[model samples]
Target: MDGRRSDTRERIRAVAMELFTERGYEKTSLREIAERLGVTKAALYYHFRTKEDIVASLSDDLRRGIDDIVSWADATPAGPERAQEILTRYGALLHGLGRDMVRFWHENQPAFRELGFGVGLRYQFRVLADLMTAPEHAPLAVFHARQALLALSWSISMMGDLPLDDDECYGAASAIASDILRRM
Candidate 1:
């Protein structure tokens, strides 16, 4: 029963993300999400009462995912090689979340800003980058660290029009990110 309930919640989130991306967050209503899910509004409300709730839940999940990555990086020895591994794991996580949510985020910066999710994630991103570079923390090193992470993040949303698969995209992004880290 617990697993079934969790599955329903995930279904609601996936549908909501699809609707939010296809129609824009501002134009999407909870009714539309429920309609798309073939569920009643009340049924949808059992898991998420509002569109904001849906987005907040997704943001929370994403934050937790990032936090896990940061925790893993923190436990490892800091070095260029470690930085490359970090980028690989980060790309894998974003890919697991699918390209639509990432594209929605890239296309809807205003909505993300309004929700305040962008600021926290951005800060955490910089902190993780700093951790990856450690000790030296030179401006140029930090710049490269950020560029490496940004390349992985952007690859998901930016290359949507291309015919390449997710694994291929991740591989290309990982290679570029590794190159950036190497330059640092």
Candidate 2:
């Protein structure tokens, strides 16, 4: 029963994300999500009362995923090798979370901003980037670290129109990120 309930929640999230991406978040409605899932609105309500709830749930998952990476990186020694590994793991996490959400974020920046998730996510990213280039913390090193992280993130987002699969995109992004870190 627990597993089934979890699956329903996941389905709702996936469908909601798709709807939110297609029609702007403000334009998407709970009824539309329920209709898309071929489920009753009450059933959808049992899991998420509002569209904001769905987005908040997804944002929580993303935050937890990033937190895990940041915690792991914090425990490891800071250096080029660790930096490379961090970028790889980060890329993998984003890939695992599905590229659609990343693309959604890129498209729905205003929605994220209104929800206050944009600022929090940005702060967390800068902190993670700083940690990746810790100890030295030189201006150039920080710039490169941010660039390396951006490269990995952009590969998932900017290349959305391309015909490449997630793994292919991640690989190319990881390779480029590795090169950037190596140079740093």
Candidate 1 TM-score over all chains jointly: 0.95
RMSD of each: 1.2, 1.1
Instruction: Name the best candidate (by lDDT).
Output: 1
Stretches off by above 4 angstroms in model 1 are none
Q: Candidate 2 regions off by >4 Å?
A: none
Error of 2 at 103 (Å): 0.3
Check candidate 1 and list the clashing pairs. none
Q: Give RMSD (Å) of candidate 2 vs. truth.
A: 1.1
lDDT of 2: 0.86
lDDT score for residue 150 of model 1? 92
- Residue lDDT tens for model 1, 91-178: 8878888888888878889988998889998888898789778869999999999999999889888998999988898789888888
